[model samples]
Target chain A: MSKQKTEHRKMLNATQGLKNVMGRHFLAIEQAYRDGKPTAWATSGSPVELLYAMDIQPILPENSATISAAQKYSRDFIEIAEAEGFSYDLCSYFKTNVGAVISNADLTKGGTGKPTFMLSTDVICDTHVNWFEVQAERLKVPHYTLDIPHVVSNTNNRQYNYFKKYIAEQLYSFLDFIQEVTGNEYNEERAKQVTQNSWDLSMVWQDIYELRKAVPCPMSTRDTFGGLFPLFTMPGLKEPIKLYKRMYREAKTRVDNGIGALEKEEFRLMFEGIPFWYNLKFFGMLERWNSIIVYEPYTYAFSKYMNPKVTKEMVLSQPIEAMSELMLSFWYIYDLKTRIKKFEETVREWKIDGVLLHENLSCRPNSCGLYDLKRHLMDDYDIPCLVISSDMNDPRKMNETQVINQIESFIEILRKRKKK
Target chain B: MQKIGIFDSGVETPEEIVMAAGFTPYRFFGDPTLQPDRANEHIPPTHCIWTRNLLEQAIKGLDENIVGIIGTHGCDRTNREFDIWIECLNLDFMFFLNSPRKRDNLALNFFINDLKELILRLEEVFNIEITPGKLKDAIIITNKIRKLLKDISDYRKKLVLKGSEFHELVKNAQYQDKNQVLENLEKKSEELKSRAPFSEKNIKKILLTGSEIDDTEFIKYLESLGFHIVIDDLGVGTKYFWNLVDENLEPIEALAKYHLTKPINSIKYPSYERFNVLQKLIEDYKVDGVINIAQKFCEPVLYDHPYLNKKFKELEIPYLFIEATYNRESYNQLSTRFSAFAEII
Candidate 1:
């Protein structure tokens, strides 16, 4: 019997800076826990700027789950949750967080201690509320669900103001909930500063994405997946801005120097769903075949707020409404037609050769309508799409050898089509 | 009369509003027997089977008389299906309603405004006025059906009729016109009240909770295993008519209040409220044990499983979790699990 060796690539220089930033984040969480400062464990998509303004340390359990999966400890944590009655088919991210919590694992192990409160948002999906509610009930802490109504249609903008107001009102209620939990007065000045920082950071994030369009793309999907940590966890603070600014400079330099994430960039591919956290190295296999994933909707989705064109002054003047707008601007929350149009735009702009759709079994919101997307891409846009079935955080669902064979076959098809 | 299609689990599409708009509100429950080829093109196999079935039915043409369809932000699967239908289904009209997850004044206010917007859209699309008087009359007719259904719900305690029989009748009512359904329910409630009560001694009165089990035959099979489901927290069953809309308030406000204040569903937030409602039902029904059966890939119910398991244990209630799908093989699979579960309890 022969075993295939897993190859690791040194992708980017900015990776070291991300590690430093994440290490500091972990230490700060630990310090907050030890000092008895109020901390709130939140969903990755929730409005954490409010928590920061209120002096409450915000901990993102989703990012922590990603960290655990990358470290190869997610399967153990997942089994712990299943043994405690979480179904095997539920979102692995939620289960991993629950398992880590039940075992009293801390920040170092991709978990956080019992916090003063928990917060969730329906901006991404209804699963966030469901997952957080359970943790809040078990820990006997106050939980708040910020519901952002889905803008399901492009022509449904007649109710745009109402949607904005609905979310704004919920933001006020969330503020009250935070105040009650921490006994901290709502600080307007601090909120303004934080909102400004977040808006500024997103602009820089967009610039970084633009830089990925260079010939011989300077960053791979694997690098961006890790680089997105601080953007998701601490975007409301100033430190991420400095780090992101540094990353932008680094990518710009790479682009100017004609450097790439791979030795030879053959095909520019796009990824549609969440990457397999357990097997991020799988991306390296594509690189070995001289195919580099230049764009990912999952990563670009975090910066969709730039589309609606909100100025920094607007964000500072009405921080709550700004937060509401940011939560509501996710492109995935809209109609399938709109999403496909956006996907088509990216395929054209990035000059994509093929599309890879990860049909993650555990995430319905992200995986649901992907089959149609594949049809649209192939039939309408003339772009080849390959769907690889797996779970984002559950390695048990993946057959690596089978996936490798499928990718190799897909790349062969793309090569043939390119020759044609 | 023209028809307006509705989805299960969310109360945003009040039958009264659809009726006031001069349309029959026909709820869609995906069939468990049909194989889906076209729906698989739009939705993956990993989604809720109930949704896939619904999409299959829609593609097959729901009804020539279906003037429009009303979709709601019910769950993630159904929520996205709203978009898919708009793109795929060539219906004349479609409307999506956004329901609030939290039960508070602000949420209520938001929901009321949303309902008002829906009413306006219905009126504009049909080119007819939905007068307040028509809304009140529609509310009265729908409320009568709910009251009769509640009355008939009591007959389950006697074990006179099988749980599947009652659910089948209610499921059929959703497809019929309101007046016809109300009349049939009134007659059925009267007939059940006069029937002789059963004296079965050893039947386990089970409380079924979770997402909608579109197939009542599954319930029948459980009953065949000596476990009789006397009550349920299913969206299509009791929760559909659990609360009546207030007649005194303005129609839109009443609709908003009823939806937000009704028995919390699985997808709602602070999931403890759902457990609280189930706890009360367990006590009221004298439930021997709970069979938590949810559709495969139904995130709301799956996410609540661990917390619910803990709550049931703390309350010393015998609980079993079952993952159900629309496939015949899954039904057969459940039989063995049900048999062992029935024997253990």
Candidate 2:
């Protein structure tokens, strides 16, 4: 029995290390909050590098909501929010956070306390604009929004040039607002350093996701989902950099050793839209069927920051332009053509056998037109796609039996196709 | 000649550009009569009904006279469907006018540049020039229609027209050509002012706030229940005609300012602006209550629901929230809620 335990330990990879780091990070945040350190609630896609440069703690309610969902506590929080007139149709993440705040659920173990201020951007989705506004009002904190216009054309077009200028000016204004709230000067040098770190961190994440292209896929979908915490929470921090480095190293080793996440890998698949955070174990069940989700577009969406070649020198010299370009390049912020192009490239690169699209009921921007995208993929790329309707945070919206049945049937179809 | 259809949501594209390019500018306000079945093929079933209805219309080529369609960013639904529209519909010209959510200088400049880009694209597509003279003329026609509509709204506030009549008049104004709409509104304004005022005794004056509602049956039914909708903050009703483009400024700049600084809506940031607008509407219209007819999955309005409730509570104003679907099958539920709200007020 002791020898078996030792072998199991050897098989355990950086995912366990990642879990430990995340736990420690949350503990540190709780300690900071208890110490009355300055903290603010920030949107996941907001310009968080500025917060790092200013030495202000940034809390992401979405991240907390996701954690609560994974822990199966989102339903309680969601009910609380729904009781407060937040409809069940609203983003479950928003509902969960609002419910937790009103009910004092403390899903973050005191890590996410009352914020000093709130900040959000309109880059990824309008939900951020609405969600942060409601939170700021409820918490009685000053809220600031960065209105990053959508990129309507190609990057080289004149419209994009105007958009870049607009975003740069808004970034300066955002900096000014942050300075007023935090009583700190805009640290250009520190911001440049943070931006460089962000670029490096994003590159590592890109490599970590790209390494899954190996046959039998080095990492499982569940591990990748767990690995997203650092990227979402500590973008410019060294912790995520270290975490991803370890993950990449382990993934490479697994690839070399021909050790896939599943004992008998048969099918490689891609996931679309946000995962049902409450039922992420369902993804592990795929491993039972010898099927692995090698790619999820959500993880690769963060790779947008690594492109266009952002350097430390450019970050310092043209800080606003650099930041504006980074914000503008967010995958979800772009048009359908770009989204389709990226998905196609990922499908080709990962050699995806099938696709599982989540028709998340709560997210409009992410979930809308997914059926159309699926049809396009089927018709143009000859890729088989199946859509499952569920909410990422709200457990009530998901039927475990139904989801498992659909997934099983989908896998059966894929297997039959392979046999044919 | 095929017309260029302009979809709603405060589109900033100067309608004059299309007109000068020799294509008539037809505003598609979405047919409430259209079913959501066709649109569900392209968009999810849970999307905003107005978007779905419009997409259904586009899918069926309901108006074969339309050669192109222009979309604007007012909400998530509108913004996300732009690509789908181009791919799903057979149109030679398609463009989405990107607008910022704030009324700051930077946002205005971005809007102005965006309008300019739209003009350049229109020129390239239709092989026509959008001279300053043509733009000014377009602005003149649009402003005239706006002034007439404002007069009509003011008359409705004075109780010269009933809520149902006001809605019908606005609906007609939305679908007609600018010249015809202006001419009809001018004639109706004079006729309404000459009529006797509506009796205010024992009648509850309420304000309606929400997205575009093409089916006035529910609203008309509310009126039959003894509630008077004295003012509206709906996208299609008041928000569309409340502000006019400045005829004195540069055509593009005026259009940009008009689009940017218009009465606040749910999609805009800083809920305080929208709250302030509602507060002023409540006081100015002497509204006894507010009925927020929000769409079920509409995130922007749902997010603003709590804020609206808080403000109404502080103001000691009675308010009711009703979530509506495109099918309008839940009229009984709405009727019960409206009756209770009427009793409270």
Best by DockQ: 1
Clashes of each: 0, 0
DockQ of each: 0.71, 0.69
Provide candidate 1's TM-score on chain A: 0.95
The interface root mean square deviation of candidate 2 comes to: 2.0
lDDT of 2 at B173: 58
Clashing pairs in 2: none
Q: Residues B1-345, candidate 2: write the lDDT tens digits.
A: 567888766544467667667677777766655687978888888878778888888787757777787787877666668878877876667888877788888888888888888888778777889888988888788778777877788776787777778787777655556677778888897887679987767778889887666667767777788888889887557876788888889888888888778888888867557888988899899988999978756677888887888888988999898788766566666777788888999
Regions of model 2 farther than 4 Å from truth: A1-12, A34-36, A107-111, A152-156, A306-317, B10-23, B199-201
Tell me the RMSD of model 2 versus the true structure: 2.4
Candidate 2 lDDT for residue A175: 79
lDDT of 2 by residue, A70-118 (tens): 7778888889888888887888888888777887766352225788788
- Per-residue lDDT of candidate 1, residues B37-101 (tens digit): 88888888878877888889888887888889888778866667787888778776788888877
What's the lDDT for candidate 1? 0.81
**Which digits, one per residue and each the tens of the lDDT, describe model 1 over residues A231-334?**
77886788878888887887788899887767778899998788889888898778778999999888877764665656677788977777777666776565
